[model samples]
Target: MKDVNFIFIREKIASSYLYFISFLGLITITISLLEIKIPSHSTILILLLIFMGIAEYFPVRFWRGTSSLTFPIIYAMSWQFGIHITIIAIVLVTLIIHLHRRSPIQRMLFNSTQHALSLILAEWFSNKCMHLLINNIDMSVLYENLISLLLFCVFFCFFNNRFYDLLMILLPQPYSIYQWYKKTVTVFLCETFGFSYAALMHVLISKYSVEVNEITVLFFFFPLVAISVISSFSVRIRMEKERLYELFLITTEISRGLTGGNLKHIKQALKGFFGIQAYGIWTKDDGNWNLLLKDGKVHFDISDHSEKFEGISKNLVFNDWKTGTAPGDEIFDSVIRSLVYFPLIVNDELVGMFVAGKSRTAGFFPEDVQSLATFSNQLANVVKTRILISEQEKRMILEERNRIAREIHDGIAQTLAGVIYQLESAQKKYRDKPIDMQQIVEKSIKDLRGSLGEVRYSIYALKPYPTQQLGLKQAIASKIKSLKQEYELDITYHERGHARALSFSKERAIFDTLQESLQNIVKHAQADKTDVLLSYQSEHVLLRVKDNGVGFSLFESMVKTKNEPHYGILHMNEQAEQLGATLQIDSSVGKGTEITLLIPDSQTRGA
Candidate 1:
């Protein structure tokens, strides 16, 4: 509750700040326009405005924001017709662009206000510098006022960036140092370009006529627009590559079945890549659609009729709220100007739905739709794969239960039944023959003990292996002690190098390999002693089990196990391979067998 209250207070403060800035900005513009005087060269002014609009339209986009060639024209205009004219012109251009883009009213206000304030400060700083440079310098002397013009560009860039930073602080978007540096460099470059072009325009206007300078301005701006268009194309190509890379990462995560744990990461990546404000994933459970994942602001009910989903299953459905072309306005909030539904289908079957929404009508372009379709297809396949894996796991569990049930019936159940029969016989014979009853009772007691042992063994087998609870070394030591007590088989355990924690899978595989090796020796190796060595290296961990017993041919054993019920070696090898490890068996007739399990570093980290 306190956190919520704190957040509410912060938002209120930010809102107040924004309103204050906007009010100041409006007041400044009103006052400035009251003193405004139209210049004599209306045709040149119109040409400059046109060029400014073009520059604003084709901004060089970066991750954080955009850069544009408007600075040169704005600076030049301020030098020619004063700061008020420059401010009004830029503000008008900004308002038009924002309105065309359907930007939020608050954002547009904030941006316009910030830009106006920065210009006012820049103009003030430049005037002070001009006075400091020369007692009474005429603005018409382009060569004499060069230093002042350069200083104006510098101060304007600084003030503009500072205001933008303040805006970011108030709104609070994610920050990146690399993005900040890139934006700073790009902005500086644009300012330099603007300074150079404005100087050239000043030179032309002073030497030639304002009319001649207008033509030069026109030609100069055309090339700039062309360059901006090229840059925009390059940015789009980069975005495409980034999108493909992001999809590859998501695909790898899904393939590893890590989606359950990495859903947050996936959501963030998708949101950043597509620039969507909200998204949701729904999966079909039985006959009902269930929401699996949802992120960002969601204002409307997602649980619409099944028929609506079925209708859109054939293709993606896009809705534009601004034009009233949306068929399902109730499904999304009024704030969402554009909403899209991508049916998650597999083999012509509607398995689920992926819904994404943005606050702009042209949010989903043709290329964006293509990418989203690919993403939806990938998600559908993953959902299907998850379902299939779940079913397979359940089936395996059921089979294991049946196997345990049979074991109980064949071993403990029969033994208990025999003990009951013997006890019943003894109870009946006790009255007639007391001496004979003692022997019968003793025999029944022994049978009961055997049944108890079988029950205990079954319980032990059902529980998790010791390696899972205890560390690998401790578990192996316990097993060796037990083997020594039970079979009187001489065993020695050795360790080398520093031990580090390994992943559960790697540990389990190593432990299982040890068990299989010992079991093979106990059953068939008619030998006296065995040795287990665990060596940990920088890049890999090695576990070797050597038995001084009657070893068999490795090739012959593998071939025989292929047909026979014995698959201990094959199973161990398969386990090692699955973990990107290696299992090697070195054995020959009459020579002792050696089993080595080498697990690389990749399998050992992330416990």
Candidate 2:
């Protein structure tokens, strides 16, 4: 439920302007009574009053909205009847109109009083001008009547419009009065035609008073004038409707471009539809305007200046930048006279701005302001959507990298290290005899060949997630850069692999195990230099991380993990189980730590 009592003329001037107009109305009525005589043709006054009352009942649609037949009838009545009778008739007719309108008591009083004042002013102006333009002549003479008639008609038109303007100055509204003045010019032109009809009718009646009485003339002609006004109004409404609907279709196309994230299409649409000299999209970040896009002949560098927006208003259509009171007066060059600004709001937040400049001969109308604002809102929604998509893309890329690295570490790297340990032990046992060494060599060769084939297949299965079916080297390179930054260790990497493919899970396992081993060296080993090697043999794929630093015994490290339950060793063992690979740890009390993972050449080994 809206409270009607909350109505405001503005933040200020409600009481003051009301009293001021009332005072002026009183003075106008007093003057009309003191210096005025009643019209001899009182019937003419009655008929005109009745006509105005009927006109008010059925207001005609004219221009963007509506206009009344009351103005022309009132002007003619003021010219024919004397000020005393005419002023009284105006008050009676206004009361009838406002009472029927159900307008508030304060508004009805102010409006009716204002109309009375302008009418009295018009009457006085006509009488003074008539006396000055022509010498005193008999009221009966035709030429004298014509001279008086012409002077009164001119004054009637001038004072009627001017006094209406004067009444506006006493009130206040949210938007600037100058903006309203610009918006209402078209309506003013239509009203001019009505006033022209009033003047012509006044002249005719004054000229032909002898042949047909004023009442008889009025009875015949009033209906014809009413019909003409209504007919003109109907035509104007039809044209306006067609124009507005066409604008809607064009704006819909522009909005479509915005949704598709086509900046070029949006720019072209704005220029083609609006016919603007320049258009710009500006965003405010930390109170500075950033020019995101500019279209058309953007001659001035106003957007580059921080001072341009200072002391500027939030009004939609404006030309006030020329005023020296504004902060950046230099931005408004000679050619730029008018600008329309629309605030780009998204989700109820004023995030940015949209502004356009008009051609030299053209200016921004209220209709243009309304239409452009709609386009700006659609653009805001699109811009916000694009920002979200960009952020989401970055997040997804990071997650994919992590998944690939984890798979390689747990499978291929673990299996190769265990095969290397078995071959090293066989070397120690077969050292005493050449015949026994031949049999050991035969078994080791067979083991290496089988391991190598499985490692190749695993790498091949991880294709499309890396460089040429291999990302272990690339993943390791990424970690090396980070480790060097985090610690002062000089690390060297070597690869000895003919194998070039591995399964995604094997790739992830190998990557993760290598990462954990290097991280342990950084945190626990007092290493000055570290060696990382990837060796592919006939039976297996192997990875090694050896550091030259003060190191603890392998037994003591395992004992700590068993009692305190650290995740590092537990995680490595879990990954080894998942990949069916082997992890090995070698260290001495004074020497550094060495970690190796080995994968064999059987597909089922890490399945």
Q: What residue pairs clash in candidate 1, if any at all? A: none
Worst 10 residues of 1 by lDDT: 320-329
Q: TM-score of predicted model 1? A: 0.58
lDDT (tens digit, per residue) of candidate 1 on 92-171 = 99999989987768878877877787788888898888787677654457666677778788888998887776655553
Residue 323 of model 1: what lDDT?
Answer: 26
- Cα-lDDT of candidate 1: 0.76
What does the lDDT read for residue 37 in candidate 2?
75
Question: lDDT of each prediction vs. the true structure?
Answer: 0.76, 0.63
Taking all chains together, each candidate's TM-score versus the true structure is: 0.58, 0.42
State which candidate has the highest TM-score: 1
Count clashing residue pairs per candidate: 0, 42
